[model samples]
Target: MKPLNDVIAACPPSGIRRFFDIAAEMDDVISLGVGEPDFVTPWRIREAGIFALEHGYTTYTSNAGLPELRRLICEDLEKRYGARYAWDTECLITTGVSEGLDLALRVLLNPGDEVIVPEPCYVAYEPCVSFAGGTPVRVATRWEADFAIDPDAVEAAITPRTKAILIGSPANPTGAVQPRAALEGLVRLAERHDLYLISDEIYDRLTYDDTHVCLGAVPGARERTVVLGGFSKAQAMTGWRVGWICAPQAVAELCVRVHQYTMLCAPHVSQIAAVEALKEAEGDVREMVADYDRRRRVFVKGLREIGLECPEPGGAFYAFPSIRASGLDSETFAERLLHEESVAVVPGDVFGPSGEGHIRCSYATALPQLEEALVRIDRFLGSLR
Candidate 1:
């Protein structure tokens, strides 16, 4: 009858999904396309979910999520990053960081507002901002600068319509962790422009070399920063779809209002599981992070040996290496790599134009599969030459 909303219609489909669907059909494909962790949810966490179900905890949680969870999240943030978030008024549990991002944008943006996003970023960042009735202004981060967004570039992009700055450290597509000085600079920038800073910290616990600085923890940032985090990446709880948002009181209250209408609340059982994750899964998280670090080293070394120029990814389980020497655009590189060698990866260009000559290879898969994928990639590169 009526056409769908124009904004929804205009949003592009996920670039990662194209190769994911192809890999799903192919019998022996080795996929490095998705950013999900391969680890199973810790047994304790899963057991908690089962216990909740057995006790008939199937009802919707409070719109802000379980009180215990919010408290634990706040304590954990303070203990780890020196950030202070009040569990009562400053934190709201969400379906996932995806939902938190959406809710934050909805609460903060009015029609025609602009959000400055640095690329190559998570696939959903730009579209989510747009779907919330904001304009996404993409500022390119250079591979030469290790993909860290420059504060100067961010400052240059701001205009009167600019409303917020969104950033992801230990970023998707490119595993670049922003530096402390850079994050502080961003805080200064936000303060200067009276803009909200949305920091996606899903990979906070997955960093390898440097500690992740919680953006809101930077001096003078608490009032203007919204911190988004989740159990999906670090706790390997992707299917559970549990995450949280921490912001100043007014912003968090508004986000809760939006979330209550749009999401109602995160699943009761999943929230219980997340509580257990925060309580007893610290050892499991450490082991998984150690495993990812090992894989990151091995994968980056393999790519360099195979003639691709890969900067060592500092965090996250991804390695975004330049395939420029192969004389193919990222889309073609990924397409041929999958068809010829059955190795599926996300083409970098789908992230943004700056990603055109690169590809994102996730090392979150097992060691044997990663090794096999490397061999196939090397063979593919040889064939290309």
Candidate 2:
């Protein structure tokens, strides 16, 4: 057999999906494995898509995407974060944050370049760097420290070849929202080293009590940061596959260049729907955020009651709870729980080596489902004891 591309072949499958696949084949299962908003795309957003489809608005948008969507995205960014982006040259609508992230990496990385990635980040980060022909230099963020990326660790990881820093807050798996000071420290680090910043803000609107500090809005970060955002988590528009990149004019242009040569443009209907999402979905977003806050309280409290000591999640809909008390590594704990209690969770070690003693459980499900899953999780822990 012919050998496949080395970089592509070397990438491991997503660990978050292992338990999810298992649960899918089972008749009675509670899955907290997938990192998605359980909420359907808001009614109005879906209706916009439907209207577009009916009206034959299926043509390809500009390579940079629909100007209207880009404008709305910029407007929303300015209103929400005081981050001003010149709609035409500084914004791009991507297929989703996934594509946006890939574009950002491609535009920035050269073969053998190093991108410092904070540990326990989203699964695709390292692989994306590899695919972009860059080296991924991982810096661990401790659960003990609320999974915050320590600037000291990040600084120590930097090297002559280091070109960028990739970060996600209200982060996946851990749900750690980096505080403003912490983020500023990171920005300083980037400025000191002349490094680019790739800030994945896909879960931006999914945050609970904490305010999401837009990295691009930071004083020293705007020119160097690539802000990846989307409608998936907040607008519950995952299936619509609409996301965006906000960056400096030069970087934005290069990203669009790669995007045009590769993805061409984001789906026209999806862009239209995203426009509607930006215009009319604030109430829907506020409602969803409030609900997620309620779930976060109940779920984190429930996790603590069951003997799993979890650091309070500052944002996002996940609770990354320590499983060390069970004397089980993350994989073993998550596997046994699935078979023993029919509750599925992602083994945290897959997120990074620093995640070895924990498991990531999403609380994006309905409150009743979350409560029931907690009960099963409690029983599973009891059996482990």
Per-residue C-alpha lDDT of model 1 across residues 78-166, encoded as one tens digit per residue: 99999999999999999999999999999999999999999999999999999999999999999999998899999999999999999
Q: State the lDDT of candidate 2 residue by residue for 1-385, as single tens digits.
A: 9998988987888888777888899978988878888899999999999999999999988999889888888988898898989999999989999999999999999999999989898899999999999999999988878888899999999999999999998798788999888899999999999999999999888777657899999888999999999989988888889899999999999999999888999999999999999899899999999999999999999999989899998888889999899999889988899888998899988988988999999898989989999989888777767
Task: Give candidate 2's TM-score.
Answer: 0.98
The alpha-carbon deviation from the true structure for residue 58 of candidate 1, after best TM-score superposition, in angstroms, is: 1.2
Going through the candidates in the order shown, the clash numbers are 0, 0
Global lDDT of each candidate: 0.94, 0.91
Shift of residue 244 alpha carbon in model 2, Å: 0.3
Q: What stretches of model 1 exceed 4 Å from their correct place?
A: none
Off by over 4 Å in 2: none
| Model 1 local distance difference test score | 0.94
Q: Which pairs clash in the backbone of model 1?
A: none
What TM-score would you give candidate 1 relative to the actual structure?
Answer: 0.99
**lDDT for predicted candidate 2 compared with the true structure:** 0.91
TM-score of each: 0.99, 0.98
Candidate 2 at residue 199, lDDT?
96
